[model samples]
Target: MIEVRGLTKTFGPTKAVDDLTFTVKPGIVTGFLGPNGAGKSTTMRMILGLDRPTSGTALIDGQAYHDLKQPLRTVGALLDAKWVHPNRSAKAHLQWMAASNGIPSSRVDEVLRLVGLTEVAGKKAGGFSLGMSQRLGLAGALLGDPKVLLFDEPVNGLDPEGIVWIRKFMQRLAAEGRTVLVSSHLLSEMALTAEHLVVIGRGRLISDTTVKEFVDRSSESTVRVRSPQLDALRSVLTSHGLTVREDGHAASAAAALVVLDSTTDAIGQIAGSNGIVLHELASQQGSLEDAFMKLTGDDVQYHAAGVEEVMGGAL
Candidate 1:
């Protein structure tokens, strides 16, 4: 497991990461989340000891990454896939890493196969696509057969197939009892991959929780009520202390009302007594991204317009 206790870092006057503390357990995927420039890259660098912490530490198993006898065998990370040389073959790059860490040369082929990079092992990295580079990076991380893994933007530029493959591979790695932590800006992708989440915003830890608990607690749960007699139901619901509002989006389709109150039971009781025939009365579920936006959006370290539209457009 990776234990980050009060891990902090600063660049000159800027505090990149502030008093962040969380535990990343094995056998599950923990998503590291934040808006752009929220210090995610800096924190990952600190974990790998590429950047020094201003205070506290990030420990792997019980010791810092820099203090390990064989850091690769203890924890492997892909902080930036772009760090690789463009001139070198993928296999050669892994071979170099293996040689540096005293890992067996044969493990190079093993990791390449593990990440499905065997076909391109002989190709130069410069000619490889973003998806291929990501695969190569993942291969390097597994070269040591480490118990811990950290990935920063593992699926940033992947195609649909590549994205799907990476998600399953991360899950499969976690199932094999390895600690896997991946950082991503794709909420929909995270909703599928992560079992737990560590949400960060403006360089501070906002939430650390199980995916289900986080969504259930932070999401705004509202009961949906649809009926042909929307007016009667709305009047009856408002009279019974259940604040009701027209679901304008749902209204044209089925004359629906969305209850603003949390008393589903009371709404049911009132609807039954008022002789209201309910077409639909169910909770409107919210996504993890929706909850995150509700919580950290105001203070989102990075704000970009049309990004959501672009992501939506891709769908």
Candidate 2:
């Protein structure tokens, strides 16, 4: 397991990470999430001992990273796929890593084949495409067959098939009782990949929970009601003290009404009692993207102006 307790880091006048604490348990994939400039990279670097923490601790199985004997055999990480030497062959890269950690040289071939890089194992790292480089990086991380793994954007340049493969690979590793922590900007992929989430914002912990709990707690569920008596339905809903709004996604002359914080049963009953003709009524569950944006809206460091803003209200 990975445990971070009150972990903090600062650079000059800026505090990159602040009192961040979380635990990643074995047999599950934990996602590390934060907006850009939210100190996720800094925290990961601190955990790996690449950067000294300003205060507090990041421990892998109760020991600091530097104190581990043959750290790679215990904790494997692929923070950057391009960390390898451009001139070195993929085989050479894993061989050197294996050698430094007292890992058997033959294990390099095993990992290469595991990551499907056996055919190009002899090629220069610089010549490989982004997807191939990512595979090579994954291979290096698996050279020791470590019990703990950390990956940052592992599917960054992968195609659809490669992405699915990586997702399943991580899941399989976790099933074998390894502690896996992945950081990625793709919320959709994270939703499918990570079983748990450790979310941070503005250098502070925002949420640490299962994906379902996070979405359920942070996002509002709504019921979409489509009806020919849209106006009557909206009035009835409002009169009943429910928040109603137009469903912008509806394309019909009678726009669909989205009833916030409501259920289909309640909406259907209301429409029925009011003699409103309903066409459709469906409950919409809050998605991961919805929850993420709602929770991290303020913590985002850079905000892109909307079209109206860009046009100075002209639109």
Candidate 3:
């Protein structure tokens, strides 16, 4: 497990991470989410002992990363896939790391096969594509078979198949009771891969919760109902203290109403009681991306004003 308590980092006059505190437990995949320039990379660097924290502590299994005798065996990380030497082959690179950590050279081939890089093990890492470099980095991370793993943008240059493979691979690692923490900007993939989330913005902790709970808390959830007797249904729903709004694209086929603070079953029961004929009734909740945008709307560091203007003008 990874424990971060009151973690803070600063560069010159700017604060990169601000007293961030969270726990990454074993047996689950925790997504580290933030917009660009949200101090995610800085925080990860501090966690791995690559950067010194201005305050607080980041611990791996109750010990600082530097204090561990065999750091790779305790915690493995892939921060930058392109940070390897250009002259070394994939196999040579892993062999060097294994030697440094006292890991046997025999384990090199195992990790190479595990990451599907066995075919390219003899190839120079500098000549590898971004996807191949990511695979090699993953192989190095797994060489020690550590209990804790951290990956930053693991799918950066991966194809669709590679993305799917990494998703399943991360899940498999978590299933084996390893503590896994991944950071990525791909909200859709993160929604599918992560069970829990730790969201930050402007170097501050915004949220830390499960995916289901996060979505449930979003105010975007509304009950969409369509019926032939639209006026009557709307009146009944409004009289019950429910806010009803017209669907933007009401058609002659049916009138649709969006009911706030209501459920499909409740709306259906009300319609049934009033002898109303309903065409459709369904609950529409905001997606993960929607919730994330809503939560971090004010915290985003950059905005495309032109894009916003164009979208607003179109609307």
Candidate 4:
């Protein structure tokens, strides 16, 4: 397991990470998430001992990263796939890393095969495509066969096939009872890949919970109703104390009413009782993207201008 407590880091006047605390237990994939400039990278750097924390501690199992013997065997990380020497061959790269940690040269070939890079083992790192480079990085991370693994944007340069492969690979690792923590900006993939989430913003801890709970808690579900008399239904719903808004994005010619914090049963009962016609009534559960925006909306450090402002009355 990975544990971080009171983890804080600062660079000059800006605090990159606040007093954050969270645990990543084994046998599960935990997502590390935050908006740009939210200090997620900083925290990960501290966890791997790449950067010294201004205060607090990051531990793998019960020992600090620096204190672990054969550190790579205890924890393996792929923070930057491009960190390898440009002239080094893929096999040469892993060979050196293994040598440093007293790992045998045979393990290098094992991991290269594991990452499907055996064909390119003799090729220079600089000649590999971004996707191939990512594979090489994964090969290195698995060189030690560590119990804990950390990956940052592992799918950045991967194709659709590679993305699916890596996702299943991480899940398989977790199934084998290894601890896996992945940081990525792909919310859709995170929704599918991670079982739990550690979300942060502005260098502060925002949430640490299961994926289902996080989405359910952060976003409100709405019922979408379409009818010829949308306005009339809106009025009835309003009279019943339901918050209703026009669903401008609906496909039908007649507008729909998006009733917040409502259910099909209640809406259907009211519509039936009032003799109102209903064409469609469906529950719209909030997605991971919706919940992420809702919880971190205010915490975002940068805001892009709205379309109106950008267009400036041109239309």
Candidate 5:
């Protein structure tokens, strides 16, 4: 397990991370989420001992990363897939890392195969595409078969196929009882990949909860109803103290109402009791992207107001 207790980091007068605390349990994939410049990278650096924390602790299995005898054997990370030396071949790079960490050279070939990079293992790092670099970085991370893994934007430049592969790979890692923590901006993919979430904004913890709980808490679920007797159904629903609004799709001829804070069964029961002819009644829960926006609206450090207005309405 990975534990971060009151972790804080400061650079000059700016506080990058502030008194943040969370735990990453094993056998599950935990998503670390935040807006741009939200100190996620800084916190990860602190956890790996690449950056000094202003206060508090970041521990892996009750020991600091720096104190580990063979750090790669305990924790593997792909913070920057492009951080490798440009002059070295992919195979040579992993060979050097393994040599330093006392990992067998044979493990390098195994990891290369694991990441599907064996065919290009002889290619220079600088010549690899972003997706190939990401795969190589993953190969290095798996060289030691560590019990814990941290991936930062592992899908940054990946194609759809690569994205699917990485998602399945992370799931497999967690299934093997390894602690997996990932940080990414793709909320939709994160929704499918992560079981738990640790969301932060402006260097502070906003929420640390399961994905289901986070979505349920952040946005109101709405019950959508379409009926020929929309007027009567609306009155009945309103009389029951439920706030109902015409759905956007309910134009001049459309008869649909979206009931807030309601369930499908309750809506159906009310319509049946009132003899309302319902064509459809469905429960629509908010998406993960919607929930993230609602929770971190104010915490976002930057915004293009005009662009957001245009895109938001269009979306």
Candidate 6:
């Protein structure tokens, strides 16, 4: 298990990570999420002792990472695969890392097999594709058979199959009762991968909860409908006590109507009773990404401009 307590880092006047506190438990995958420049990399560096924190501490099973008796066996991380030299074969890379940590050469081969990189072990890491590099990085992380792992955006450049394999590999490691903390941008992918989530924005903690609980707390469901006579359909739907709003681009032009707080079944009731010709109707429950956006709204680095909606009538 790993615990970060009030971890903070400042570079000049900018605080990269601040007051970050979270516990990553064994037997589950904890996801770390933040926008670009949101202190994620800073926190990871602090964990590995690559960067000195301005205050607070990160611990691996109650001790700092550098103080561990067998640091490599205690924690494995893939922070930047790009750090590997271009001329070194994947096997040679692992050999050097293993030697640094006193890990045996046989263990390197074991991890290469663990990450399915044994066949390409002789290939230079620089010549490998992005997906292959990701795999090689993963192999290096597993080389020491660490009980704790930190994977920062482990799926950044992988193909679909590689992404799937990485997801399964993380789960398998957690099932063996290892503590695994991973970061990723694909909400759907994270949804399937993480059991717990620690979300951050602007160097502040946004949420820390179970994946399902966090997502549920941040999003809501709405109903979408498209029809030629949108105004009439909007009137009828809004009159039935459901909230209705006219979609701007979809309104007037495509004639689309958005009915808020309308369930899939209730939407059916609205259509049947009002005789509203529905070209499209789907319950639009927000996704994990939407939840992330809502939870981090104030800290979003990029955002679209505010949108306006035409109104048939306010609910």
TM-scores across all candidates?
A: 0.92, 0.97, 0.93, 0.97, 0.95, 0.86
lDDT of 1 at 38: 82
Runs in model 2 lying further than 4 Å from the true structure = 308-315
Clashing pairs in 3: none
Summarize candidate 4's per-residue lDDT along 1-315 as a digit string, tens digits.
Answer: 999999999899999899999999999999999999999888888989999999999999998889988998999998899989999999999999999999999999999999999998999999988899889989888999999999999998999999999999999999999999999999999999999999999999999999999999998899999998877888999999999988879766767889999899999999999989999999999989999999999989999988888999675
lDDT of 1 by residue, 1-315 (tens): 999889888778988899999999999999998888788888888888888899988988998888998889988888777779999999999999999899999999999988888988999998988888888989988889999999999997799998999999999999999999999989899999999998887789989999888888888778887777888888887776776777878637677788874656767778888888777778777798888788777667655669668798775
Per model, state how many residue pairs clash.
Answer: 0, 0, 0, 0, 0, 0
lDDT of 2 by residue, 237-288 (tens): 9999999998998886758988998889988888888788988899999999
Q: Report how far residue 92 has shifted in candidate 4, in Å.
A: 0.7
The TM-score of candidate 4 is 0.97
RMSD vs true structure, all candidates:
3.6, 1.3, 2.2, 1.3, 2.4, 5.5
lDDT of 3: 0.93
- Which ten contiguous residues of candidate 4 have the minimum total lDDT? 246-255
Query: For candidate 1, which ten residues in a row score worst on lDDT?
Result: 296-305
Mind giving the per-residue lDDT tens digits that candidate 3 earns over 164-271? Answer: 999999999999999999999999999999999999999999999998888778538998898878999999999899999999877766669999888988999999
Q: Which predicted model would earn the best lDDT?
A: 5
lDDT of every model, 2 decimals: 0.87, 0.94, 0.93, 0.93, 0.94, 0.87
lDDT of 6 by residue, 1-315 (tens): 989999999999998898999899999999999887788888999999999989999999889987987788889999887779989999999999999989999998898888888998998888988778888889888888999999999998898998899999999999999999998888899999999999999888888999989877898768888876677777777678888876665735567767877676887776777776777877777789889888887887776544442343432
In candidate 6, which residue ranges exceed 4 Å CA deviation?
A: 225-233, 246-256, 269-281, 302-315
* Candidate 5 lDDT tens digits, 174-240: 9999999999999999999999999999999999999999999997799889999988999999999
Candidate 4 deviant stretches above 4 angstroms: 252-254, 311-313
Model 3 misses residue 161 by how many Å?
Answer: 1.4
